[model samples]
Target: MERALKRYWPIFILPTLLAFLIGFIVPFVQGLYLSFCQFTTVNNAKWVGLSNYIKVFKDTTFTDAMKFTIAFTVVSVILINVLGFAIALALTRKLAGTNIFRTVFFMPNLIGGIVLGYIWQILINCVLSIVGEPLLALNTQAGYWGMIILTCWQQIGYMMIIYIAGLQNIPDDLIEAAQIDGASSWTTLWRIKLPMVMPSITICMFLSLTNGFKLFDQNLALTAGEPYHSTEMLAYNIYNTFYARAGAQWKGIGQAKAVIFCIIVVAISMIQLKATRSKEVQQ
Candidate 1:
């Protein structure tokens, strides 16, 4: 049986592998090549070396988008993880209607990003209208905070579920031992629960970080990089460069920006994994 299973494993995996190659690797290679070429279409691509990359660096909108994206990612990652963990802790306690609360909190995550964006847009605009301030589309600061709030609201519940799973896995005996040793609640959390939950923390942080960086549909539907493109994020910037702008050169530049964006996300995710995994305590 073992021999048959091992022999058939590749057969079982071949279809998915072929699909991955066709769906991802092929297009990725094509995109990498196109990043160095100027063309309106793949068939007409003409290699221009690193000129597209150079143009990407020189684009002020790209730089601004990069800065804004980094700031937003940092804020959203922190808020989502912290708030999610906090809620998980609360919900795990001896509280009434905990399941109901969990369901309510998690429902937002089920909504599509574009739908969430439009819904939040109307909600935010209504609030600003009541306050007699400029709408989200016209106010850069408002747009930034609105995105932050929207991201946190959508992600916190998902993270909470992960945290709850992690927290529940912590042995009751270990917690009792901590309390028996006169450890305060805060001490138990800081020293025991946190370390035990490090794996979940790593997962949640990676998701939040990457989602923050790759955000697009929400950014588009929410602010549309309005008020002179001050709120444009890196993903939106790449999209604008590729589709919104005219000319073949812009396409190549957008491709280069996308390649750079991919590299940035991979590098940052690697760094985050390394940092978080180091602190993870093996159970």
Candidate 2:
């Protein structure tokens, strides 16, 4: 079996390799090249050096989007992880209808982001209407909180599933041993349960962080960066630059913004993984 598999490895791999090159590698390289060129379309792109990047930084809207995006991502990441972990802890006990409870909680995550955005907008506006305002009223600060609340409500359950799996993977013998040693629940939680769940924490953090940064549909559907682009995030900012405006040499500038956004997200994810990994302990 080993010899046969080894001999046929390339046959199994070739199709996937070809698809990857055609689908991703080529397009990715093409995108990088286009970032330095000015064009309305792929075929008409003209080299424009660093001007697109300069414009990106020069736009105050872009800067505001960056700040807003970073702030939202930070807050959302914390809330999602904490709430997810807390729910995981509760659901781990011997409760009736645990599966049903999990399904109910996780249903929100299965909903489309755009749908969730509108659903939340209607609900929030219904309450805010009493104050003579609506979801997109006032400024980005209001939109920022609305976005955070929407994110937490939608994502916490998904992360909760991850934490639940981590909790279940922990051995009962370890908890019994800790209890026998006169360790209290707080000590056991801080020392044993948390360490055992570090893997789940790492995964949840990465997902929430990346998703927070890349959130577009919800932001678009909910606010569309209304009130003078005050609520615009990085993704929406890029989209507005790419399609909403005309005769602005959209393609290259959008591509450049995308490339920079990718680099920033990758670097931040790497740093977060490194920082969190250092504190993780083996069970």
Lowest lDDT block of 10, candidate 1: 222-231
> lDDT of candidate 1 vs native?
0.97
- Model 1: per-residue lDDT, tens digit, 171-261? 9999999999999999999999999999999999999999999999999999999878999999999999999999999999999999999
Number of the top-ranking candidate, with TM-score as the measure: 1
TM-score to true structure, per model: 0.98, 0.96
Model 1 ranges with Cα > 4 A deviation: none
Report the number of backbone clashes for model 1.
0
Tell me the lDDT of candidate 2: 0.90
For all candidates in order, the CA lDDT equals 0.97, 0.90
As a whole number from 0 to 100, the lDDT of residue 111 in candidate 1 is: 95
Number of colliding residue pairs in each model: 0, 0
